[model samples]
Target: MSNTGSASFLRELNPNRVEATKREALLENPGFGRVFTDHMVTIRYSEGRGWYDAKVVAHGPFSFDPATLVLHYAQEIFEGMKAYRLPDGGAALFRPDANARRFRNSAERLAMPALPEPLFVDSVRELVRVDREWIPRTDGSALYLRPFMIATEAVLGMKPSPDYLYCVVATPVGSYFKGGASAVTLWVSENFTRAAPGGTGDAKCGGNYAASLAAQAEAIREGCDQVVFLDAVERRWVEELGGMNVFFVFADGSIQTPPLTGTILPGITRASLITLARDLGLTVREEPYAIDQWQADAQRGKLVEAFACGTAAVVTPIGKVKGRTHEFTIGDGNLGLVTARLKSALLDIQNGRAPDHYGWLDRLF
Candidate 1:
């Protein structure tokens, strides 16, 4: 992974921009990821040239050959994060450097050239700086940033591509939990496996998400909000939800989550929760949690809360776990105290309402 800090070069595009009047109309009810900002960042890469052609340009589509490797082989990866508008009229990115590092890790895992860390940060900052006006000021809202890389090589071979393209896009988003942070229902999948022992679960790749859509559709059809996947090998140990990591809160004030067992995404929110829990003087553990344990604990009043964490939801309470033969309801089927406290603490830090004792926020504009 390249540790370079910032890009040495940047170019501005023509000022023929689209006005935000129509966008503002959408922002009033900007239900997640529906409306996009006017600008985007892009950089190109080849074996000999490395990463080049860094620029901020108008938001538009790109032409790709029919034989593009990504279209055929699915050689792509991406990262999701947010930029918050502080009350002081400035913008901040939460743990952006960590995202950069994880982006590089995802690139390396996919056999793609890693963009220099400096270039990555520079692209994000430049885009957010230009589109700072799009950062939503309402509570529980943010400017969602998506950075992605795709193999652009027009070849038919099964080998890795030598050419790639990296781009960043932003969207104004509202709270993921539309009504409120109420408890959610989950569907347990016994017929599908999200990842294997040596699979790309450790990387945030498009294919991983694409593979989960069928299971997710099944969950929704069964009247559940999300699908919980188990380990691919044994299909017993708990893994994660479709797009988020899982957490379990005990009645004794302790917390636990499934470990990074090479079949789970290492979420930034997951890591932050561990730190926050430790700071709150709660004992936290990372281990292999079984689905049966959750059901048994809820039955015995030992497991008080269950939630999922990611960039989109931040933190969401899990009220019920529904499987083929059993259904379990946790802690009166409502949000628990530990879950509420952790969510508020993380939000406060991101929104500049609390002290950033860990320096997790980076001022971009």
Candidate 2:
């Protein structure tokens, strides 16, 4: 499955099939990532041919050799974003090009072939176009898109694969908060680190999440909603949550988030929140926020609100920070005014209720 750069070819699935009732039932709940849409997009890449064989096919499994490079060396990268159906029946993607750019960056970082921007954008557009109805119109619901690339060469010597595969799959998702937006508890993981200095933390890859799952399981057992990781070097400065970026609101009506210290995932929603905060006339700072500093401020009444931001949850308030022997509760253990306001603003822009001042919305249809 190699492609010549100038060839215009896409193999369409002959069956073109879907189970209607089953899909409907799944969409009724559409719990995140459990069920997939009817169709998926795929394109192949090789050392000599680049990316080719772009096509939309029925969602199904792939047959891969046991010696596939990705199976051994894990030369893979992925991204997460969403598409929303607006009131007018049209669909929109929140800064999809930004995701595309980040996908390319991740590929470069992992020594995988960069899927051309046009192909990447077109692949997403085609998927959304075919599966537009799968995009939920309910509030706080969307069609979650997962785009990924895997090295597919059938040798496992650890060198970059001569062949690669890039794919996009989508799943309808309901509100990340099962009931409603509520304050969450976080466990400080002083023993385990999600990413180390000069690591793949900045990339949207699966290994990082896989590495954090153990610590996340421990946090859950400890009655915390999420795990907060510290810098691997000193285990002092706060990096981020297991899957999201952290922010702090101070008594002085200012905001602070851990700076992008090369060991943190520069979340797309995190950057947008910073921009929106500035637009809302709030003082915002990005620096090394230490765990000690967070506790000290909570005691001094300076840390008023805390939250985590990601594409999945949008924004969630952090009600309490619990460590092995210490616990600090923030702002009555409820969603603060600033946290609620920011979440609403971002959601409004996402749902097409508020103006997209930053030109973040990209219409898919």
Candidate 3:
């Protein structure tokens, strides 16, 4: 799938044949990534034919050859974002354009065909419109959208596949953390590093997450909720968690997050919070923070709070840090004021409870 050009057409719509009725039950307790909607969008790409055969079909299984290149080489990438059910009984997407750009970046990094930005957003829009009812009405709940592309060419000898498939699937989710917006514990992993210099750390791909699983399992064993990784070179500077970006709040009323040095995921939610924090009269800084500094600051009461941000988790407070050598609690081991305020501000904008001062919400209805 080498053709990297813009193409447009009407997608063939094939709605779900069955009428959905378990929505209330699912919405009541739709845990993260468990309950999916009834329809999905798909688009195909070939070396000769740019991008074609777009369709909105019923959610079902797909058949593929055992020798498919994606099965072996893992030439695939994905993006995670959400469609929020607004206060006015409508639907909106939060910074989907940013997700579309990141999707293209991931595609370029993985040697896959680049789906046009318009095409990408349009595909998601169509899917969400068809399954708008799947958007959970519960506060702090949304329809999680996953857009991905995979290498489909059967003849594979460690080369880019000539055929590609791009798809979008959505699921109604409540909270990524177990106990709703409660604080969480983190396990600092000194043994495993998520990405190295000149690696695929910045790209949103499957392999990065797969590589973090071992460390994540270790965190679970340590009775922690998530794992934090340090830089791969010196192994001192704090990088990020398995799937979320980290932030720190000082007792002097200031904020700092690790700068994006082509080694961090550059989370959309992270960027949004930076703006929102500034609007709320808080100083936000993007800088490299060391693990030892975090521990020292917390111990001395200089660092009052810490948190992680991502599309799935949104804004989650980091209450405690359990490292192999050291362990400490941030503030009172509870959700801090800055963390709660930032979460509420972002959620208010997303759920239409507050004005979208930055024009981040893209209303679909």
For model 1, the superposed segments whose C-alpha errors exceed 4 Å read: 1-5, 14-16
Off by over 4 Å in 2: 1-16, 19-22
lDDT of each: 0.89, 0.87, 0.90
TM-score of each: 0.97, 0.95, 0.96
Question: Model 2, 57-173: lDDT tens per residue?
Answer: 888999999999898888999989999887788989899888988998899889888876666777787888888878877787899999999999898596988899888999999
Q: Kindly give the stretch of ten consecutive residues in candidate 3 with the minimal lDDT sum.
A: 1-10
lDDT of 1 by residue, 1-365 (tens): 22344564365653865566766676677889878888899888889767777788887899999999999999999999999988898989999888989999999999998887778878898889888878887788899999999999998989899999999999999877666687889999999989998899989999999999999999999999999999998888889999999999999999999999778999999999999999999999999988888899999999999999999999999999998966999998888999999999999999999999999999886
- At residue 188, candidate 2 shows an lDDT of 95
lDDT score for residue 149 of model 3:
95
Give me the runs in candidate 3 sitting further than 4 Å from their true place: 1-20
* Greater-TM-score candidate between 1 and 3: 1
Steric clashes per prediction: 2, 0, 1
